[model samples]
Target: MLKKEEVKKVVRPEAPQYVKDVVEHPPFRVTTNTTLETLASYLRKFPIDVVPVFKSIFSEDVAGVVYPHTSLLIKSKKLDAKIGDFLNPPIVVKESWKIENVAEILIAESKWGAVVVDEEGKYVGIVTLRGLLSALALKEPKAKSVAAIYTPLGEKKSRAGFVKAIERVSKIFKKLVGGEVDGYVVLSRENGAVGILTIWDFVKSRRWYRGAGEPRPLFGTRVTRGESKHTGVVRVWRIMFRGVAVATPETPVEEVAKYMATTGLYVVPVVDKDQRVIGAVTVWDILHAYLYGPKEGREDIEVRKAIEIVVEKPTLETAIGIRPSKHVTGLRARDVMLTDIPSVNIRDTLSRIRKVFLRSRSSIVAVLDDGGKIVGFITRRDFLTYIAEKSLGYWKRQKGKMLILKEQVAPGETVRILVEEGTAGDIMKTNYPVVAPNTTVEEIAYKMLAAGTDYVVIVGEDNTPIGVVTKDELIKAFKERGRKAKVGELMTPAEIATVNFFASLHSVIKKINAYELDGVVVTEGNDIKGVVSVDDLALRPIEETLRGEKIIFFTKSGVLRKVSTGLRRLRYSKVGTLMAFDVMRPVSLNISINNDVGEIIDKLLENGVLPVFDEQGRLVGVLNKMDIVKDLARVYITYAMPEKVAEVKEMEREIKQS
Candidate 1:
């Protein structure tokens, strides 16, 4: 185990740096009085995403910012209008702000950049994602592994399916737009990381339909007839970009940024030796690293003595082998279901459904029959899909004008018109998944996953809609149950993978990736020294001398062989030189094996893995969210539906065999 003094030696605090050091002059600026045509010309001339709009040139007061995409909302006839009408508020920060603080603000707001202001609120310059990356590339500070910056996908967010799963597109889109993930890492049982889907891919593959009469701006209010049928049946695989660049946990953040810059890829999957994706690195992550160095430190554990206690006592409503009844002992659909669900009559127009969504701020709205029975449903995602299908071309005026004098409108107006004219029954989905009010939360999870939806509707005995359960509710239930369950009940047994203390960094990474282990126990002879997990190894700094170094180690047979650092030399440097003791974190199992899983939930999430120890302080097992979720699901399945036990067992057997 590493001592407190040793742990302090590994901590690297960055020197103070302000945003002014990296700020650059704005490439172009527009005034509020500028014509839309002038703004469009400037946007076309300069390859920039956001343009700062000033209240006046002399005052240098920022009114707002305009994105290149904002043009899609304007009508051709309105091009002469002032640009101020469509301005979005700009994110402004003081020049004295720390780079990391600015990065956090931008990340939180999902903005690409912010306008730098002086103490008096005068515009000084702009700091953008690109500018930060370019500055960091030039500085080339000590490189850190991608693991420190990448976002882990865990079991719930990761997707495994056939490449042609068109129905999964909507779910993936929701995840992307909702900020759940930067991209979807498409996995395969046989092939591992097969492909990746990002927002850029969706933007590039956007197709316009001419059969929808005329295309208008994305936000146009004009009504049109009929809808495009192409988008619904199209396979996502056809649009998914393949053969994307991949990174390993050991890959340096600098290298990942370089790949992203050289290629047009915005998201890169961090895979293991077997090519299975464990996490993803996005442009935003790279910017984060540039601002805040490699992320370090494990969450402190709170020690609690082991005691004999029942984790959960079954009630008559939840007894094993008994049929599930209303309001089970644990969380159920009724407990988390939303009773005030948004809805629209079957005969209501799409315009009405849109109003409900905006007013209620709901993701899904139920389509009800005259008797108040749910016949179908429409989601915000559905509206996005509808817009995508119809906003492909310019809408041409059909009457009161010559062929050359026909008025042109944006796709938004055309799509808006189509939606207003269509009835709820036209676009509402009837195949949505549903569950009974008495259904267990875990069962609802299964249904949502199988149905490729984020929510499940709960109905009463008469088959009338009662409430709705969403991912938010499911997460709340898991957290509550997790707090009551003991670590022993959720942990993976102590038969863990191990590596020698003298092992090369290459070997350590190979072991981790080969077995798909979150980390490995570092051993010196028969005793454990420390643990070297992916997160641990990622925090190790890359030195110039370590690059391309040759490492020689002896095998059990006493034969010594040399290994090159390879192309990713910065990451694969000889661990013997850097010392595994420097990279591995101290292994102190303060978290008791018998303690509630909730005590370590925050730590497990932060470090990605934790070791469990028994009463006598003997290494017993490891605990992670992946194992806990799997166990919880299994337990819930058995308790709620006894008849499915055999089938669930069969599925588990196949999983183990695979």
Candidate 2:
């Protein structure tokens, strides 16, 4: 794996000293001196996706633009029209702001691109929609996910607190980058909105995601390893997930969600005075308890607590289960127990940990050492990231490296690093930080960035593994599943060999094919470090797993607007497969011969339920629609010379004569 230092060089760097240091100058631009005919013809010939709006106001003052299909030089139109007529008010940002903030503006505005402005308000460069999207990756959500949160700063902060923050950040990453975006924890600088704390800060700081748990709300599944005939077998200690900050068995209707939110864990484990694992809490359970039960439509976060404030603590017999299911009227640690939680011993092989988890329908596997004490846990998603990090192969001949003092990278560094390395482990990281099973999400996000890793192993009192929590687990707290549970209640334990980190790209495929598992865990010795997916490794060509083919469209920004507006004209709202959630906004493509056209076409089709892209990323030309017409003839071949407009008009005139 790439050393944390190497990754930092590309991610962080000191401030640039000069005006020209941060911005790229001489960026491609278009001028007002051009004629409509020439502009239209130029758009077709040029490969760059966007054209600079260059009018006489300032050499770099971007004013307006025109699209590929646009024209005004017709028989009835003026030939001297300038492209400035179509320019819209420019959206600009200072080069000093981090790209993370830039992305927020981009997503909110839904514009073609944003302009980079200097302190003096002079234009520097532009970040197109495609450029911004290329800088970041978006993802679809997982099944049964929620986002519980944690604060980066709290009264408990210290060395342990900082590490906890890193662990929480690693967990949040499960939802932010490759995973889906769920609910988020707002880390206020002073706990009173003094300043904003963002995920990027955690990453730039190299902190790990130390949240309560990933994809929280452990509901079911129990597993037992195959019998060993040797000296009999070992029985691991069942983790007691009590006193883990959950609603009281007697917590009232409204207070449950508020308490769940405070913990930033999906399921808050309920416990008795003995601190034994009794009942469980999940977002799904709370939703049902409130929606279909006594509290019909109250969205208040403190209703259950509200009852506690007014009425005194009542007797358990009367307060516990007034309703038929004994779930809604009152709840406690015992009423919602997910009896047989999956767990294992530290001495167990990593492969076995993988099996116990796959066998159990739970989110993680809990592990104990020789004395049957809880050590830590492992989640399926982190297992996958570990696999991907370890499986990464490099071509030493192409190795290059970039040193970022801060979170900034350039194209040159990427090329240099790729040409260098040869082995997979040469690019993987080891000896990262971890978190405790009981740590709250509020405390873990702060330390995540400093560690530079993406996950935290949740261990029980005796250093025995119980479960793994990830960023995705935190986000899932609110989006779809259980929120009344704690991190231990939801985490997946490392049981069967979670898989190896450096297995041949081919070997992993065979394992996935053989076991039919979700993905194989990648590990070092007995410890689970990472995991590999069948989807990324199943292809024949080894490099196919490394990079993806991309496509581009060259057009003026106007066409992009027209097309996107047309597609969204129906304006349907609701979440389902039918909704084209991944539809593209108007995007400009920088077409070049070096890229794969087939891959681009496939990606386009995969995104929008249709195949199409115009010069300006508009639907003026549909892929399927174009194909049918092409089949009707041989192909769409342009004439060597322009068809005579006079002849065409004369043909219409002759029809009237007839």
Candidate 3:
């Protein structure tokens, strides 16, 4: 166990003066006026999957929302389309407030929270729902859903007691599957009551007892569908800190990584002195910069002149993840920042913010002003605060505990009593803690630790907050800045290395290695779109690797049954039917191509698919897996084509109108 102070004192050598500054990452904002086509192009440029939507719709004082996975965006992008109209308000926030405030607001809204304006109407940072949850994971009490009270089913049972044993297990399984008492039971095989088996043992079924024969696959009567639907409709509500982070042009590189890591973020959007997201510095880039300093140094003295002390033009495309993490431990600011990123207007919403966050896995919403300068931050936490405050107000009104504002009081008569009633304005914090890219650990750590707040808004020399620095970050840097005797510096502009969206995941993977990267920036021209990370492509299952030629069958029980002897495949329908004769192998399961779900799960649980096959073996479609869950997410529905989908557009319109 480590005390907060103890954690703060172990100065990380990598976090030298150089790390405080940065190189490059991603830009924060985009305009609502930009068409969805433009936004889709951005999605292909980055590794993230979500972006924040900013700007109000209908000339109202709020920005609405949009998502990439929904059919609305995907359909248009796949066919070169755009969002014809705005949907919802964007998540907004002020830079001065605590990050936790955003978490509170999100919970109250029962929707993704949006951090809007203060009473005086100043734009702040936008926080996502997950951003709030991330902060809460570290600094707040957490809630966990309690499932069922589980107990082991005794293994003791007699051959006569087998029926009873199965019954108990079934009851428990039913409760869990039925969504009743959320719990599971252990399975067991009791020769009598004394012999016991666990639920784990039951699920790990090896070979059931056959009266006088060798082990054989159990035949289930049920059948199921194997095809998955990628085109189904889904509802998605996403939030992003649709903004960027700013640092003084001179901030150190190591400190920049420290700033980003403490917030549990990988990319810190770097801004110029003007508060523009000029570039970005990622953890790997800054780490490389720090390591650049300690390599066979000629001498410790003359720190600025030390060999390889500064990082120049440090694009991942150049260095990639080439050097070991051990190196680049004390390099300078000039070594790490990638100058070329993207930028968007604050009024831009629905496209970049929601999708970029999804691809980059970053939380900060970099708010940029009219000149493409970062001026504010939008974090998930900010949204939570707004919703919570509003929800509290709603409840107060319901309980008649709400206070009337002085502004709403009558002007002429004695409205002093009414004026005494307060408004949410009376309780909202006017002064919130924030930092700028140039702010040092010592300067900001004190504020963060004292307040127990994690997110700090990063501003520029102009006093406008451009990004954010959390409490965790300040502590990390403050402790580490003291250890190293030498440091590095960087000042070159950063550049992005992008790939075409239509490129195969394989091609993207190849490009990553060429760059020696953990991820690649997917982009179009100058705008950011999406990001592709190594992790994103790592788990893809390869076909033609299932070990051997396979055979499928359905048992009387309706479960998918596979029987393989490393030679041939077989499908069976019924056990004692005339179709069983002259059969080289028995086909167990049968299937149909229709899209009904409830009918499928029931058939699958029986054993495998249904139906008996003919001698000619000309067959219909088969069933394998349910797309119910897949349809819930954003996926490319393959079996159903797009043209066939448009016929139902009227249904979509009707629901929207209703």
Candidate 4:
């Protein structure tokens, strides 16, 4: 018979872990030119504590780093400025460095983590405090439960007043030395953990109060203050994240650390079987354990070969010869098509079509014939074009070309009435792209790009619509494949269209129409000031017209008057005068042409388009949703089904021949 300790050791074997085992790809990296607003948007989406900044995409030189807390501290107006203007020098370490040494450096520097580089001095990945904790937890399986490491929320602290209690909790988080904690949980007598709050919530609330047009606060409570008052009290219940995840006291420390590492959530509240709050486990506590806990049997492993860091998990699988399921080569249009279509009769009034667009929340509305067969389609762009033309016509009919009117020339209601009089067929695009239900998703994607559209309608045997495939569906498919292709391989190479910052709105509209572009970059000399898109120019006016708001015009008499006229006042306005700096998303939202396409798919889906730059920071091409869809289709045909390559080529030839 073996002794108990000897038997336990035989049952579970221990292996040494290294920093390379725990390092992961950073969520996203930004260039020094990235703006605070764009950084904030990325932080809001991923909730990562630190963001790495590179000198340029072409090199591995570290510029600096941006913290979420630092981003929140800047005024909203200054968000348009470049991040390089306000950054902390980055702390870098070798990939082979010991985890314990890295932890000491992070604590001593009072930083989140250091950027990891390969022996060749090239960027590889990041090793965070959270990652170290996770490695430690895995190395010590027999370690104590979460209760041993959690910070107890005593009865008195749990029952304290909302604001006062939060202040105290914030102080406790501030005193931690190793890892940073930005999240806190609220406990109530009835509910074990009522809600969770992070530093993000407070910053978001500030933006809302400053009228930056941020989304309403998550907490349903509103803050009211006098004109002279600088502060307002807010109830804790209104601002906390009510659906926060919790861990039981008896849960394994490794389990909690694994959850934090996977989700980027650094804090978890501990509860008892009765659902009463006991304590909380944070990233700092996990770090403390790894730094001071038992290391009796643990050892560090040596890394011989350099490991290639992949930012996406699925990409790593692809690197190892495991193709994702969506790229199985048998997916057809029917497999990924959206069956619930929004449609209207060809003869339906424009008013009816508008209502359908608003209700369905769709960008495209199918136009059907009398027999319920698809004939054409109406897009939001079409409506915008109609309004712009009508407004221009009404302006042209008036005698004054540049005169500021003192009174109403035509009631704003006239444009609205005229717009509603046309039928869907009057503005519907007849050259809409169509596809067969059995067509491969790749082929569908190709047709969309060749036709210069974002979607393709799937037809049945009789040429009637069965379903539709859009860029969104293709994005999902591409995300699953986890291809390692670079953005330069898929982006549409074109000279960037630009307009002077001082140009009039009339010139801006002309440039857009002439180039058939959705937007143009605004520049001063060679520097990019901002971007003005179709949404800013056309959609905004249409929304104002629909809302029955009076258009303000300043007459030569120097008095501002509310006129019920058409869009004549806006036609001659300077772009700089009317354009909102915040509307300039491209100021900081660009990607390197050499970056992996998988890293920017989400950004393309969100912005509809992105500006691609070379190593020299010069705009080389534009990568839009259509470009990605086309590439996905091409990849699918090339790898998944090689036999279809010739067929796709012939289709391309036919499209070009026509």
Backbone clashes, each candidate? 17, 148, 198, 1
Worst 10 residues of 3 by lDDT: 541-550
Compared with the true structure, all predictions reach lDDT values of: 0.54, 0.32, 0.30, 0.56
Q: Candidate 1: which stretches are off by over 4 Å?
A: 1-18, 25-49, 56-59, 67-86, 96-98, 137-143, 154-242, 260-266, 287-658
- lDDT (Cα, 0-100) at 193 in candidate 4: 63
lDDT of 3 by residue, 587-625 (tens): 334333332334334443232222211244423222211
For candidate 1, give the lDDT.
Answer: 0.54
Alpha carbon lDDT of residue 205, candidate 3?
A: 21
Provide the lowest-lDDT 10-residue window in model 4: 405-414
Q: Estimated TM-score per prediction?
A: 0.35, 0.24, 0.21, 0.37
Off by over 4 Å in 3: 1-28, 47-62, 69-72, 76-81, 96-101, 116-120, 143-658
Angstrom error of the Cα, residue 47, model 2: value is 6.5
Instruction: Please give, for residues 1-658, the per-residue lDDT of candidate 4 as tens digits.
Output: 9998888767853322555655667566788888777777666545544667889977667788777666553453465778888778878888887777887787667666777887887877776665665555456543345655666675332211222223443343232211244466676655466655566554444443243343343357554443323333445555554434556655556656654553445657776666666767776556655666423443222211111212222221111122222443457888888888699998886556656765676767888889987788877667656644544321111111111111111100011122224677887888868888888777777567556565788888988777888777887777766366788876655443565555544455555544435566666666776666554442232110101111221111111112431222221111012222222333558689898888888877655556778899987766655555655556554666655556645666798999
For model 2, give the 10-residue run with minimal summed lDDT: 542-551
Candidate order (TM-score) = 4, 1, 2, 3
RMSD of candidates 1 onward, in order: 25.8, 35.8, 33.9, 26.3
Which candidate tops lDDT? 4
Superposed Cα deviation of residue 632, candidate 1 (Å)? 74
Error of 2 at 117 (Å): 2.2
What is the Å distance of residue 318 in model 1 from its true position? 84
Q: Please report the TM-score between candidate 3 and the true structure.
A: 0.21
